[model samples]
Target: MTFTFKKAVRSESKLRLALEGISGSGKTYSALRLAKGLGGKIAVVDTERGSASLYSGLPGIPEFDVLELTDSFSPEVYVDAIHAAEEAGYNVIILDSITPEWSGKNGCLELADLYSKGNSLAGWKKVTPLHRKFLDTIVNSKCHIIATMRSKAAVSMVDGKVKKVQDKTEQRDGTEFEFTVVLSIDRDSHNAVASKDRTGLFKDPEVLTEETGKKLLSWLSGAATISPEIQAEAEKAAQLGVESIKNFMASLKESKPDQHALFSDAEKKRLYVVARKADINATQQGK
Candidate 1:
């Protein structure tokens, strides 16, 4: 194998964001605002029992579709909801509190227990594939995705003084890595910090709003009106780690009729190169 270097070119990409905080940290509200700025029909996979809808009809927020995942927080349900949103042609889908899909009722934790039979480490093996499927759904989905996660926080007495501190996400470990950006918030102050950012667009802790979404869109879009289908295809191929570029090329050739018409020959080739690079990097890291 040989390496080839070429001048870097910019390509549009979808936003994969995770907003995590303790209760009252404004995750849902902020997510809605950001989704609005991304600009397309928006949908919310509300897992917080209608909490997200509370902000609906608010003064400045735009109208969006909401699919409430009540009762069970199953991973399969979350996956299906995302797929349905994409099929419905929504531009952005917010998974409010993906944490429960991991640790809540019938979630990954239960699935792991069913397979593990007592050994926690062995249980992970059973649950990992399911979790990976959900992550892949997020990475490969056709629309921008913003997920919220609940964080554990509590007060403790240190030297007879009370203070609050951050704790782990209610979801399982390593879930945060699935997102391109992860924003953590202070529960009381309602300020956010970009704990993880691949784009380097955000700065220190601050409030996130529609303007934040606008800023994100500025970088995500350029003169090129990158079609949503192309973005979806690139993200999926990159994250799936498909080994054969030839097979990927075949898939692109057979894209949906509309997408096929929209993507020019040069654009197809560019997207393939990008997907190939992403797959190669994913393969290397997995090794």
Candidate 2:
């Protein structure tokens, strides 16, 4: 199931990629990697600390740009920054964090949910109709967008003693509710997991590109989604893995100077068969 969003390549295609997890989820770095791969000027809307600076230094963030907001900042500043990007025709845009603006006003998503005027239903409630007017004007613009949310690791105690399950949780700081896609840092493993992706791509209940899943499935067991194109890619990676498999390769040896050997034809064939099986498994499971 190699996935390609068949949507024709619009000059300013709107993409809403999200990352959510508790602290240490490595979401920031991953966001930058995605930005680099996408290859265009991406806006880094910073509401948390100024971590975008750290991203700027990385070789991975070639097209990085920053938009900083402080405690005293207003929503218009954010709107303007996005407006500027869209008007100039940036290929990618990132709202590193959109919660702070509402959080400062003590009116985040939950309040938006509680107040009938706030949700998608009523369209971001306008007290004077000015803010609503402003928000509408922005979303209507064309910009490939990615937004990040802050998250906390939470556990529910079923009996008030026995722990039930770990959850990527969001609690309102006040009247403000945070958006989902809260990427966190890992304690030891340091791998980013999409603790939750409301749209169900690039997160747990992991949505792997078919090729990526095919290549990586040997290490996983949970549910995964793969497109046909990615499935073929998985097969290729598997076949390539064989060259490293049959070599009996040891860590670079002081005894042997520099030496290497190619995979035996037999080894390549064996790995290719194994990869094909894995691809079949993914396709059957998807059905």
Maximum-TM-score candidate? 1
How many clashing pairs per prediction, in order? Answer: 0, 28
Q: Once all C-alphas are superposed, what RMSD does model 2 give against the true structure? A: 12.4
Which residue segments of model 2 deviate by more than 4 Å? 1-12, 71-74, 105-139, 155-241, 244-287
**Candidate 1 residue pairs in backbone clash:** none
What TM-score does structure 2 among the candidates reach? Answer: 0.52
* Whole-model Cα lDDT of every candidate shown, in order: 0.77, 0.48
Q: Each model's RMSD to truth, in Å?
A: 17.1, 12.4
Cα lDDT of model 2 by residue, 1-287, tens digit: 79767654223324445555555555566666655544456677776679777767655455567767665334566677778878776766776665454554433443345455435556345322534443453456565555655665666556566432335434323212222233344433444455444424333322112222222221122222343553354345664444333232332122221121122223336566775666677678789
Candidate 1 on 22-53: residue-level lDDT in tens? 88888998898878767899999988889988
TM-scores for every candidate against the unseen true structure: 0.71, 0.52
Which prediction has the highest lDDT against the true structure? 1
- Measured on C-alpha atoms, candidate 1 has an lDDT of 0.77
